[model samples]
Target: MNVAFTSRTLSLSRPQLFRGIRKVQSSFATCSVLSANRAVVYTSNGDPSQVLSALTFSNLPPPPPNTVNVRFLLSPINPADINVIEGVYPAKPNPNASLSSSGKGSQDEPVFVAGNEGLAEVTNVGDGVTHLQPNDWVIMTRQQAGTWSTGMNVKPQDILKVPRSLNDVEAATITVNPPTAYNMLHDFVQLNEGDWVIQNGANGAVGQVVIQIAAAKGLKTINLIRNRNDIASLTEYLSNLGATHVVTYDELSDKSFRQRVKEWTGGKNIRLGLNCVSGKPTTLMTRLLGQNAHLVSYGAMSKEPLSLPTSLFIFKNLTCHGFWQSRWYDSKSSGEREKLVETLVGLMRAGKLKEPSHEILTIQGSEGDEEASQKIRHAIATLAKGQHGKKILLKMEETF
Candidate 1:
């Protein structure tokens, strides 16, 4: 609560906002001890859909130069994490390699941590590390290898200096959704101001951020939500976030709906489309695009294969693309990344960017410890539920 925001930029890839007043507080903490140590361990190499076990803390490796030992405050179990545990995703981290680098051998093959985003604090900083000190909070640069653990030794490169302005809960929600949204918008296609973008699964984590970021950049969004349960209210909520239109899967088929889309844009060709639900939604979205537009598919929520019409492909010359945010951010320069992080944190703190709505799974006392891990797995299995909000989160928070 004592953290302060300085009148400076903290920073991402979407449309780089210029001329806007932005500032960040140096949110760093130093020198704290963790007592009630524990971690959510994956018992078998299977569905994080069921549950994750609570385990005792063991030995951790010494921090090398520019590396630090972190005590995790919170972590989110994203849909991506579930896919990794279920052996469906390809971006699995080398938890074994992370351990081996820590001078620990893996005849046991170090327990694989399943998340791609987290907020942690340094209890100790190794030699030659001046930018970070004890207690300074940082988000994993690239999931930080094994973040589900209560403690970890990670390189500075994989940890971004979190704006001391934000909470672990807010920072925990970040790292993935914001960047994915930013990248998908800025990369693949060049969207001009006032251009319209359409996306299925527009109510999920990445999709929600896409709405906010597009709004911030003066772009219009036609968001597609599943037709179920209070979707009208959900539509209104996203409208508050600057979505130009909120339509259901059923609307995509109506020729009248396409006419309304043109009306909203005033016939401004839709330049880009984002697809997470494949099959029918994917095909319908292509039909609605203008010539040479790009469709970027990040996930297949409907679990259906994407199909493109041959006419739209050759005649319209539309481009199809894929976005893997983890891979792209991993390849960017640190300076470029620092800019992105600073921008995102500044927006979040200023309340310009809405934080991903999360259900906090506390890791404290007896009750929290008993159910925290299970709650994490459950959130992932049903991330798309809970109305229109993204499943932002806090995993464990036991204090000294």
Candidate 2:
């Protein structure tokens, strides 16, 4: 076989190229064209740097019956997503034969795409589809749907259309952290207007959402965060988010802080406590709650066992429970999920809920796959280092 390779930069933009192709297709005698559907996939469970690579297919088949073809708009680099890629999370991706490459895979092995949540645009839909159409924005309704790609073919039942008014960052991140906050607040305890809720890790993604959502509901928050060099600015930021009181772990440790909290609450009972950081700080926070209070644990960033006084459990009758959003989705019906989406989106549209702060990492298509692959690798690297306190989002496509 004789092969020739040549490179040229076409001045035609994507829209212009599509128009030119449409015009030439009716006149040309013979033509061969293929669409490049590129994705990041891995074959084994390990570090993403060693396991992940860019895979491109020359052509994609049309959506089958009851399915839709979607192009991903933006996906987030969440810590849980990285854990899934590393094979340590409770949920794992199911491998598919569609990812098999001619030169990259063994005949018996399958591949998995990375990412759990994202926003996608419907480019095409098959027969019998009624809910979504071309240019409609949608988000994954289930976990482990593999969203880190330029495009995918998905089932209509697996996605829900989002409000068009939402910006890219807000829509991209809605499925995970925001829902977690919403569910945790409602599922564990019943809160009323002017009721007080105290939480640690108030600077985190879920924490931020909890603060905003609680405030919108006319509830008060006592936010606990770590002491940093810029504690003053951090306090101001959380206060602006509608926290009734902002205190550092150092302040939480002070023996005299209980009186201060008592004065801040003006004799009202703190009915609920949210603990994501389970350490001495949370141990101390439990002491501030009123009788019959509920303490819900979602995450443990400190990696330390929660130390609680035995008397508080016995005397105050405090209840401790754990919450996981993934489990909530698994046990709920489709209609329930739809209702939840509507509620959150409605809050967003009414200016009641705000998306957490984030930074964008564009991974646009270019002349070669190498550039796209490198951008993905760099984004994953940035995620590993914690993203400097900003949520990292991957902008997969340039258009739409």
How accurate locally, in lDDT, is each candidate?
A: 0.73, 0.83
TM-score for each predicted model, relative to the true structure = 0.82, 0.88
Q: Write the per-residue lDDT of candidate 2 for residues 1-400, one digit (tens) a residue.
A: 1123234326667787677666665433232213456667888888876677766654447889899999888888888887888888899888866754554433566678888989999999999998889999999987888888878889888899987889878899999999999998998788999999999999999999999999999999999998888889888988888888889898888899999988888988898999999988899999999989999998888889998999988999999998888899999999999899999998888887887788887765442456667777777777776546888887765311
The most accurate candidate by TM-score is 2
Clashes of 1: 13
| Candidate No. with top lDDT | 2
TM-score of candidate 2 on Cα atoms, chains taken together = 0.88
Tell me the tens digit of each residue's lDDT in model 1 across 144-219.
3667767778888878878667976778777888988988999888878878898989888788889988988889
Local lDDT at 73 for model 2: 87
lDDT of model 2, residue 22: 66
Q: Whole-model lDDT, candidate 2?
A: 0.83
